[model samples]
Every structure is written in C-alpha cells, then in structure tokens.
Target: MPLTFIDIERQKNWRIVLFFLVLMALYLLAAALFFAALLPGPLSAEPRFWVFLVIAAALTASIHFWFSASNAVDTVVRRLNAQPPDLKDDVHRMFANIIQELHVVTGAKRNIRCAVIPSLSLNALAAADLKGNAVIAITEGLLSRLSRPQVEAVVAHEAHHILSGDCLETTVAASIFGTFSSAMEKVRYSSSNRLFASPAFLLAWVLLQLGYLVNLFISREREYRADAAAVRMTRNPLALAETLHFLSRGWRGAGFIGSGFEMLCIVNPVATTLDETEGFLPDLLSTHPPIKKRLEILLQMARVSITELDANAERRSGRKGTDAQERYFVMSPARLWQGPFTAGELDALPWLSPLTWVANGKGKTAERAWKDPLLNTIFLRRLAGDGRIESGFTCPVCKQPLVTAAYEGTQIVQCGFCAGTLVENGRIPRIIARTGRERPCTERLNALARSVLQQNQARNIYRKVAARGAGQVPLLPCPKCKNPMFRGFYSTAHLIEVDRCSNCGLTWFDQDELEMLQCLIENRLLPDITVAVKD
Candidate 1:
C-alpha cells in the first residue's frame, strides 16, 4: 500500500490562485465602473444597473443553493458514518468473494478491502493508492437489488481498477477535488447570509463550473480504462452489462439531484440532450457516457459466441469487414493536437506542429504541451508554432498518450509526448491482422455506427498505413501479448510490433497501427496494384 492521502493542501493553493485571479478581475471591473460614474450623467442610469442587480440576485439564489448542498455531507456522514463502516452478511461478503476471485484469476495482489454505504442506490466505486491500500465502496441499494453475478461483476470491475493503478490516479484526482472543494467551502459558504451577499459566491460558482468540466474529462478516461481492464481480468463482460442494467433502474430520487460525483453514482442521473421541446445541455459536461452505450459495450464483450457476435457487430455497423480479417488499431489524442509523432514529420503537418500560439499544447498541462496557445495570445502566435509537448507521456511500447478527444468517441489518441511500441513479439502483427470476429472490441465500430445511424457508415474508419522515422520498431514486451515484443515485416514494406496484452487478451496500439497492419493485409491481396498506386 502506498501513502496516497489526498494532497489536500496543494489542491487548496490552486483554488486560492483561481479565487484571487477572479477577485482581481472583479476588482478591476468595479474600479472601471467607478471611473465610468465620472462619465456622462445620462449613461449612469442606463438599464445596465438593473441588469447587474438582476444578475446579483440570481447569484444570491445560486449561492444559497450551494450553501444548502454543502451541508449534505453532514447528513450523509451522520447517517452513514454512525453505522459500522463495513457491511455485514452475504451481500457485504460478496465483494470480498469477488476480490478473492480476481486475485486468484489475475494474480493481482491481495489485502483489498470493501466498504458498504447503507443506501441501496445501486452504486459501487473504488479508491486507494495501491493494491493493499485499495477500498471498494458499494451502496447498500446495489447489494439488495442486484444478483450475485451482478455484484461480482461490479467488484471485478473495481478489482481491475485497483490492479491497473487507478487507485493512485484517483488519489491524485481526489487531492485536486478535495482542495477545490475545501477552498470553495471557505470562500463561498462560511455563513449562509455572508455567502449570498458576497460577489465571491458568484465567482466561486463560475470557477466550479470550469473545474468540474476539466475534472470530468480526466475522470471519464480512467473509467473507460477501468472498463477495458475489467473485461481483460474477468472475461465476464456481461457481468458489467447485467450490473449496469440493474443500475439504470436504481433508486429513483425526487426533484433535481445536483451535478458531479453524486451524479456519477455508477448509474448516472438520466439526461437527454436538449431539443426544441426540452431544455438540457449537451453531454460534454457529462461524467460518463450514456448508460445505454456502456451496457452495449459490455454486452458485446461478453460475447458467448465470437463469430455470431462479430457478424451481429458487422450488421449493426452496416458493412462487412474491409478485409476478412482485420481490426482497427487504437489512438489517444495529442494535447488537443499539436500531435505526438516522430520529430521529422513535424514539418509536413504545420497545423499539427505545436509551434503556433493558437495550437500549442499549453495551459492545464504546461509541462505536457508547453504554454497554451490561447493563454499566450499574440496575433502572430497561432499562425506559426511547433507544438513542443514534453509532458502527457505515453507508454514506450504504445506511442500513444491517454486522452479524451470527443464526446461520443472513446478516448483514443491524437498523439503523445513520449511513446514506444515493441512489435518484435508476434502479437502486434497478429492483433492487427486478426479480425475481432474472433474477439471483437465493443462490436465492430462500423457495424455499431451503421446500426445506430440507419445507414452504411463511411469507408474504412481505420487508417491505411503509417510510418515514423525511417519505418522501424524496437524490441520490447508486447503490449497485447505480454510476450517478448516481436517486430514483423508486413508485405515487403509495412512493419509493426505486436502491440497487445497476451495475459488479458486486450490489444494496445497508437493511432493507425491498425491501418498499417491492414495495409499489409491489403497489399498481400493486391500486391500488383499497390506498386502502381502513388501516395
């Protein structure tokens, strides 16, 4: 177990910096208003005063609600904390059983612990910095409502998280959240009346909106990674699917349940995108993908029959495989895309070169992408910049960074700061060459898209072929096969590492490793045509 107590203090400084920046900006705004009072008398009574007052009143209402919600923990802790921290009985023991099962199956470390909240809200989550220190928390609601398999399914998912180093990742995230939450409490809720009257209340509100948005982006990736890990560990994908099905119908609450972690209770608060008839925001602020999609993925992974499953997947995607046997590779976005690639290709992708002020990977990850282009605005900066990204590291064997590139798309890559892929093991080439028909990942992409879209999807969503720095791969452990990585020469030209895990059977690769793998397949089928074709 590692000491991963939330970095509560450091997080607070960030909140303080944000608070002061907001306060200073507001101070300057007030000073400008005072100076404006010295402006023409006619302008003084311009209805902007009324508008500002209205905004202040709205701010007061918002602050009041914020204050009220902050006390929720007192009630929750008072109720939940008083009970023995651990649940007793078959349901409580179920998590332990699941953890034990995972340890035996995955050879994961033991000493895992479990806690149950008395509520039957169908929620289960994991926390801790290391295997021995990890804690799995489940709602009493989930235990009462779900089947044994369903409960174990959720536990297995959490077990994979603990094994995959998510505990440490989350400990870090919690530190940030804890600091922000604490500072927010100090600035906006010291007293109900004082908070309502102060402009800092409104300022804090704005800051929270932004902070949560940023947090959601990071959190979602970890969730998917956890899901992928679970599938590998248990090979019981339907456990998760079954669990989610039960969860969507979990405890129904009256009225609006506020946003954020509370909303992320395994089962998310149901929301539909706003249309002309209903008022709702897009899913961008959402903490997780729609429950429907999550289940769809698990159900696919739980395929009792891979051939039938792949066929169904293909139909849903509305196209036969471009090649009889091929799967697309994986991707992770660059810091919003000055992209991570070998340095030599940087010149051709000028827009991709993080050199210009506008596109430089900056801000949230200065060490990752350098200074943010938006933050360092000089008129000429956007036009010419080399997106120097020294952070947001990726695995040397994968050459891909962890990222969330779109609201609907899975968190795949655009690039990374440091990346490596060992293809010497036969797995990379085999993974690329093999059709997921034998082992599909979330149903074929094309099949799912077409079924959902009610039309045939675009041609070859996967890239064709890719190369970097003289077309070479290094020797390392295979990301997919876990064997000594093998570098295979595809056709006569394309070469790639078998980038996948052998133990769990999940594949790993950056961007179009699939396409390069695919191109090799195609060139083998049509060797004469390829030489005739030009880039």
Candidate 2:
C-alpha cells in the first residue's frame, strides 16, 4: 500500500516552511522601505532605524491580528459570504455529518466550524487562523450537484488541510499579504507626488510578485497531499477523481468566489480564460495541479485504466443498451411528446431538468419508471435532485416537479424546471424575516443580479420580462391545489408582484425573482422595470 499523505516525509514539509519564512523576511524588507519613507530624513537614513521600524510594524500586525483567531475566521467567513449550515436541512445536515466523520477519522478534537456560501458555484475550501479557529465552507452548487460520496471526498480533502496545519499557514500568509496590499493601495493613490519617496509600495509590489510563484507551487503540492489524504479517509479515490473531472467540465466563467483566495480552495475559484495547453508555465503558475494529471494519479491509485473506469461507471449506473436499440422519450417545452431517442441521446440535451418527463424503453413514464429501485438510482442522479428522493410537487408555470430546499429557518419548494421558488403557508414570514434581519452583502447581490440580467439579456427575454410587469399577467393554477393563484405585490414597498395560492397559502416567485426580492429587501428599492406606453 502507498504511504498516506499524513505520513509524508517531514523534510519536504520543513522545506516548504523554510520557503514561507524567506517570503516573510522579504515582506518585512518591503515594510522597512515603507517605514523609511514615512519617517524623517536622518532616522530614515539609518539602516538600523528602518530595521527596527519593520520589526516593530510586523510585531504589531501579527500581535493585533494573530491573537484573535476567531476574528480572522469571522472576517474570512464574512468575506466569502458564508452562513452556518442549518442542521435541520437534509443537505446541510449531510454536510455537517461528513465533517464530523472526517474529524473522527483524523482524531481531531478541535471543533471545525462549517458554513455554506449561497453560491451556485461548485467549490469547497478550508481556512484557519493563527489562534486555531478553523472553518470549512462549501458552495450551494456542491450540495445540489454532487453526490454524497463526492461531497465526502471534498470534505475529507479540506479536513486534511486543517489536520496538517496547512490552513493555519495559509491564513498567516494571507494576512501578511493583505497588510502589504492595503499599504500599497494607500500609497499609490496618495495626493503627494514625492517621486519614489515611498519605496514601501514598490517593495510591497515586489514581495507580492516574488511570493506569488512560491505560494502557487506550495499550494499545488498541498493539494496533491490533500487529495491523497481524502482518498485514504474516504477509501474511494475514484470519487475524488470523478469530482475533479466533473468540476473541470462544469467550469462556469470566473469571478464566482472572488480572487486572492483560490490557493485555499480545492480548485481554483477564479476561472481562467486562457486555453491551458500542456506546458510548464501553466503548471508553474496554477495553484492546483492540472485536472488531467490529478485524474491520472487517482486512476493509478485505483489501479484502473481510464477505459475500465468509464465502463465501470456506466455499469454502476445500470445503463447498458446502445443508442440504436433503446427508446427514451422526453416532453418538449411545447408540451409535445418528442422521443424514441436512446438514453444517450436524451442525456445529450443541454436542458435536462428533474422536471423533464422521460420515458424508458418500455414506454413507461418517468413517474412510473422512478418506482424501480435500480432505474431510480441511476437516472435520478443525472437529474436535478441528485438521486435524493424529494416530495413530488409540480411547477405551476412549467408543469414540472419541485424539490424541497431549506432557506434560513423555512423550508420551500423550488421548481426544477422554471427555477421558481414556492413558499407555503406561514413560511413566507420566515423567508422575509431572514432577508430583512440580516445585513445584506450589497456587492455580492449586485454582482449576482448583473450576472443574472446579462444571462437573460443574452437569451433575448429581457424585454419580455420587463414588459411582464406592465401587463395584467393571466393567473395560473396553484401547484399544490388546482385553485387559481392570485397575483399581488410581494411587499408594500416594492412594486414587483408574486403569485399566491389563496386556498393553499402558497407564494410562487418566478425564475430570478427570488434574488430580485432579496435585492429589494436589501436596498429597500422599488421595482426597477419601466412600463412601455403605446398610442
């Protein structure tokens, strides 16, 4: 058996630590320059004075920030826009359980705080402060998209970082870098044009540049070790390998999790537009190893060839028939039955939702085929729910299934087809309260809104959506009961309206409307739409 990551050579670890210390010295050198510029002529001229200044500054910063680890962890959690996982929520509960299991396996008694970023971006990362407060945060996409095994793989990887003290080092390095960055920014924009008078900013920039490569290299090595450690803990290298492949394939264009923190994440949070070719420059600069290389290593560890693994995965999913022989049908957006395509063909569709009605080879409806234990396991995983069984409820607009999702303290049903959300009965209060009570992440909300609007505009539905506000939209039947739903304003302050089932006490928010509602609540703004006047 190959040696586990935890038992890796100590000499290599010491070498990395030495490199980090060297980087720290360079940072102090840079800070010395900044102090020299800030001080008077004679004092600045004395090299001993500059050295003392840098030491004092470094000590002050380290003492101020490092002593209170909770504050550092809290700052990071807030920066990443993370919230504590609701233990009552199935997904959140499962995530918490995974961390607990990893802790038990590693014999780590330090309580690992768990949080979730309300992002659809598929990423997970670990962070720790000098005083030992540690946090593990995963995105909403990870819970919604990945399987339990995959989630465990991710959690286990993060656990390794925490256990091996990587997260502690990361936090300290980031703090040092951040201090320099703030100083640089202040000096760069200063009104005084004392040409090169403040070499501190210049020195800070140089330290950042030199440290970048070393940091990237060390981060990449840590990732490999984490991968190995996760595999050992999960006893499933294939799951981690598949996760890497899935994440690489699902790369949504960058700026999801924010930059400068990519080194801490399992995968680089910032998406690169550069077409990464087989080259040294990409590998050297990347904070994580190439996906292909990681996959290959995992496959080697699993003792399975690529072809074998692919075949095994298919067999495990119970998908055996060829495209020519099997007949799988799907309901089109027009409510027309379009089919006789094979499972492979059906899978090729870009917009396959759990709400999508699919028929098997025997012409059995998805509802009926879903009863089969074997078929349910395989097909449901490919669907939006990820094989986790959900209570059945149809989307009133698209006439598709809805999945239960826990938001804050309330449980709401989300339409897998239309991307709408339904809050039933007294749940609306909880939903509204959650939004109203908390301080909003204004920048995050704005970025999210901009991204959503850009996507809608790209689809040419921006005009139609804007016009939707001006017209008396026809009422649709309630998803819960077939009663006519009433359209009314969501709040007294906002002009935006939502559909509510009077009888069933259900409120329906259309696609992207939930986000808009949150924004309205955050900013206390009225409807942003303009009415089109006609002659």
Q: Highest TM-score: give the candidate number.
A: 2
Q: State the local distance difference test value for candidate 2.
A: 0.67
What is the C-alpha RMSD, rounded to one decimal, of candidate 1? 30.5
> What lDDT score is found at residue 388 in candidate 1?
36
lDDT of 2 by residue, 1-535 (tens): 5645445322245654675567566665666666656655654356676667877868764564454343667767887789999998999999989888876775566678899988887888888875678899988887767789989998888877876777766665555565556566776677276635445545656766775655653546677878888888898998898787677766532476555566677877665632233466765666676767788899899888878866766675464344335576767767777777755666666565545666766856465334444333444555454653355877776555668876665677886556788887687656656774444546766566555544433323444555555334668788878787887656445444578887888888887677666775666553334433332
Scored by lDDT, the top model is 2
TM-score per model over all chains: 0.37, 0.52
Give Cα-based local distance difference scores for all models. Answer: 0.44, 0.67
In the range 1-535, model 1's lDDT, one tens digit per residue, is: 2211122111222443453344334433332333333233443366886467446544643453344333433333233331323435776666667766766665443456666666545576555442235566677767766667767777766765565554434343343344445545664445566445545455545554555544333344445656665666566786667666656655532122223334324444443332112113334455555666566667667654435544554474465433232211112245343344332333344333222322222223322222433222321243224343322433433233323222112222323322222232344445445544343433344333223222111111111332223224455454333465333323233333334444644344444445444444433322222232223
Clashing residue pairs for model 2: none
